[model samples]
Target: MRFSDFALGLGVAVFGIAVLLHVRTFPEIPGMQYGPAFFPGLIGAAFLICGVALVVGSVVRGAALTERFAERPAWFGDRLAVWRAVGVVLSVVAYALVSPVLGFLLTVALLTAGLLLLMGVRWVVVVPLMVLLPLFLHYGFAQGLRVPLPRGPLELLLF
Candidate 1:
């Protein structure tokens, strides 16, 4: 997908404005000079400046600034790309529904494997990553972050 500099700039400016506005409500840390909002506020200011620059650049260049961002994407005619995109959406939906029942490890493993296969990854590479990646992620989130993961029969045994 592509967007005219004008539209993209406007979007960035709006987002920056939103961030700056919302960050004002965050209370300053009692002991520290930099509050939670400090870094984000700086980022928002940067975004605002860059967005204005893009808008100005587009205006100066006299490009088609009013054109719709996504009239027809470059990949519109690519069937495989379209299907892969659909598969990603479907995968997310499937994960939401199946994760609770199958648990985090199993659900993520299945999702990773399925997506890898769909993307035409070799079985040799897919098999190891399918098992290892989910395990590592589960350990990191569940153990390191102390986040509670949904436990199914398999995880009930391991975790």
Candidate 2:
């Protein structure tokens, strides 16, 4: 559904302000010029500025406060688009629910392969991506970033 520029701007401004307030609660590092909150605060400030600009621009252009939701086309008007969106969402949800049981490698590989196939990708290309991508991401997160991912029976045997 479409929203009026003014409504969008107001919503964005409120979200930005909320982000700013939330980020302010992050603990500061001792003797650091830039702390944990620095990046988030910067993003919040940018959002706030952009939101204010949008609000002012909309007002200057004499835009309405709201748009007619019923005038918009049905969300599922395009069958392929709707199906693709649903497929992606379902794949991610399945990955989340099944990952702990099936492990990250198997679950993500299957999810990637399934999504690529859904998007009409060739099995030749899908096969390599399904295998390599999950391994690469696992290594990056588990080794490089030191973040632990869920490990199932297969992962336990291998790693």
Candidate 3:
């Protein structure tokens, strides 16, 4: 659905405030400034700031809300765009459903490759992205974030 900048900004700002308020109720760990809510709170604050900025910018520019929208191409009217969007959504849903059986790395790699292919990306570029992106994400979440991702038989054997 389309929304004016003012309306969108207001909605985002409200959402951010709600997030901030909800996160405040989480239990804080002693001797640590960061906790489960830390990242969420930061994101909420960023959203609030960006929303306010958009609202102010729109007002200051003296541009009508409809004028901003008129500059954009017709997304829903395009057949290719609709197909691309559907493909992306299906890929994501398939990844989620298959991840437990195939493991995060394998499932994500396949999904990425499929998406890249759908976007008409070259095999050379798609190949590296499919291989590297999953590994990087796995390392980042498993090691950096200390959050373990699901492991299938293949992942169990390799790592």
* Candidate 2 structure quality by residue, lDDT tens digits, 59-152: 8887655443124447669887788889989998998899989998889998999899988899999999999999999999988998889888
lDDT string for model 1 (1-159, tens) is: 687888889889999999999999999989998999999999999999988988888888886456665456867798888888988999999988998999999999999999998888999999999999989998899999988988897798996
Off by over 4 Å in 1: 29-34, 64-68, 103-159
In the range 23-86, model 3's lDDT, one tens digit per residue, is 9998899999999899999999998998887777778877536444423447878887888899
Question: What ranking of all candidate models by lDDT puts the best one first?
Answer: 1, 2, 3
Residue 130 alpha-carbon offset, candidate 2, angstroms: 0.1
**Number of the top-ranking candidate, with lDDT as the measure:** 1
Compare candidates 1 and 3 on TM-score and give the better one: 1
Off by over 4 Å in 2: 3-68, 71-75
Global lDDT of each candidate: 0.89, 0.85, 0.85
Candidate 3 is scored at a TM of 0.52
lDDT of 3 at 9: 78
What's every prediction's RMSD, in angstroms?
5.6, 6.3, 8.1
